[model samples]
Target: MARAFQLAGLLRLRQIEKDHAASDLAAANAFRRDAGERQARAIAALHAVPVEATDASTLFAMAAARASSRSMLADLAALADQADAEVAEAQTAFGEAKARAVGLEKLEARHNASVLAGELSAEQAAIDEIATGAWVREREGNEA
Candidate 1:
């Protein structure tokens, strides 16, 4: 009975680990997508700043602003690359966790089957003991 409790506790722990892994995968995917969106928005804003042609000084200022925007977009692209790496790591962890969950399920099934077989054997032995005493006929008709 104590062993059974221990086994059950271990199973619960594995299940919790499996759940955490799944969550980590989701978070990583979300972060990757968010980073891409941020980079796209940065580009759009840079493009939206239109250049005016009335004055040479204003035109040069606009050009400088565009250059700055390009630099920022490049930075965002680097961030997206970092996010991709995180997503890949999370995917690996998710695969490992999924495998573990499946393996644990199989192990639990095997343990249950073994326990049932043991109980069945004990019951069968008890039945055999009872039948033998009654069916033997007490020394073929009692003499002592």
Candidate 2:
């Protein structure tokens, strides 16, 4: 029988940690995409605001609209920046997690290979012993 891997539990924990990090990275990327889309919409709205006005009231309303659009754009830009930072941090975390998991995975592979080799060697030894016994029985029968 093949021996079980000694670090199987630790390997499982590393894999779980890596999976969680991947989820966090995905969420961070989604938030960044959302922030970018909002920023783009704000920019488009700011550009769409009318500059031309026929009267004082219309001019005042236009100014207010442009001001509001600009303020929204600024806020959205800040949000986008924050989202970018979050994505960067998440990517770093994911990379570290992956590295840890990969190391353990490699170790597990080596352990499995060693166990297989041992089993194969034992099987071959048993076959050799059986072959030797058969040869001895045939020779003793011929001598009789």
Candidate 3:
């Protein structure tokens, strides 16, 4: 009988961990994209604000709007940076998980190969014994 892989359970756990890490990385990437889009919209709105003001009050309001846009853009930029960091962390975790799984996978492959070889050898030995017996029986008949 072929021996089962000893680390199959551990390998399955490692694969699960890798999958979770990949999911986290995807979410981080999505957050970064969202932050970038928000920053772009804020910049566009800032530019759309009318520069020409007929009265001092209008000019002050425009200035205030521009300031608010800049502040929002800055916050978004910071969020994007945080997202980038998270993505990097997630990528590292995924790589580590994959590496851990790979070792077990290779071991399982080797174990399977060894079992197959043993089975093939046993079959060949049986065939050789049957051929030897037939040859001996024929020789006895010829001598008789």
Candidate 4:
């Protein structure tokens, strides 16, 4: 029973670790897509103007590029923070899983030892019964 509980706990902890890893991967992928989009937008703004045109359109485009770059930087910072948090959480969950697995292994070893001890005791009892029966049969033959 104790072994069963430990195994159950280990499985539960491993599941949690898997979930945390999935979430971490998703967040990283989202961040990558966000960076790609920001780069594409910036490139588009840069390509909007000819080299000789010094007009408001060109200035606005440059400003827009700067703003987009800054926004992307801010977004990346936020994503980094979120990713860090996820990594910490996943690490914690993995540690928990490792601990649970170790505990389950110990519990199983203990249960096996107990089973072996009981078997030995039962074998001893059987041997004593057989010896007594054999002795009784020999004495009956002698009396005859």
Candidate 5:
């Protein structure tokens, strides 16, 4: 019988960690995209604001609107930066998990190969012993 991999549990845990890291990376990328979109919208809104100042009140309102849009854009930029950092961290984690899993898999493959070679060697030895027994019986009959 083939022996079970000694690090099977560790391999499973590493696989789970890799999956979680992948999920986190995807989420982080989505958040970054969303923040970028919001920033673009804020910029567009700021640009669309009418510059025509028919009176003092309209001019003051335009100034306030521009100020709010700029503030929102700055906040979104910060969010985007944070999201980018998260993605980088997740990618690093995924890479490490993948490397660990690959290492364990290689070890398991090597162990399995060794087991198979041992079984084959045993079978060959048994066949050789049977052939020798048959040869000895034939020689004894001839001598008689």
Candidate 6:
């Protein structure tokens, strides 16, 4: 009989952790994409603003609008930066989780291979014993 893997339970836990880390990384990437889209929209809106001035008041208003748009752009840029940081952190976490799971998986594979080799060795030994017994019986009959 093949012996069970001693760290099966731990391996399972590691797999679960890896799955969770992957999920978190996906979510972080999605958030980063959304932030990037928002920033793009903000830039487009800023460019779309009309700059034509008909009077002093109109010019002042346009200037104020430009200032507000610049502030909004700055804010969006900050948000995108924060999202990028989150993505980096998530990637690191996923990498660590995957490394742990891979290590355990390799150990499990080695253990299984060892068990199979042992079972095969035992089976071969049994076959050899049977062959030896049959040869001894035939020799004894011939002698008798």
All candidates' TM-scores?
Answer: 0.71, 0.93, 0.91, 0.50, 0.80, 0.90
lDDT of each: 0.82, 0.92, 0.88, 0.68, 0.86, 0.95
Q: Candidate 3: list runs displaced more than 4 Å.
A: none
lDDT of 6 by residue, 28-144 (tens): 999999999999988888788787999999999999988898898899899999999999999999999999999999999999999999999999999999999999999999999
Q: What TM-score, to 2 decimals, does candidate 6 have? A: 0.90
Better of 1 and 6 by lDDT: 6
Error of 2 at 15 (Å): 0.6
Q: Which predicted model would earn the best lDDT?
A: 6
Residue by residue across 1-144, what tens digits does model 3's lDDT show? 788888899989988988888898888889888888888887887778678999999988988987887788888889889988988998898899889988888998998999999999999999999999999999999999
Could you give the candidate ranking by TM-score, starting with the highest?
2, 3, 6, 5, 1, 4
**lDDT (Cα) of model 2:** 0.92
Q: What are the per-model C-alpha RMSD values against the true structure?
A: 4.3, 1.3, 1.5, 6.0, 2.6, 1.6
Higher-scoring candidate on TM-score, 3 or 5: 3
lDDT of 3 at 55: 95
For residue 138, what is the lDDT in candidate 4? 98
Ranked by lDDT, top first: 6, 2, 3, 5, 1, 4
Clashing residue pairs found in predicted model 4: none
CA deviation > 4 Å runs, candidate 6: none
In model 6, the clashing pairs are none
Task: Name the 10 consecutive residues with the lowest summed lDDT in model 4.
Answer: 1-10
In model 3, the Cα lDDT at residue 71 comes to 85
Lowest summed-lDDT stretch of 10 residues in model 2? 42-51
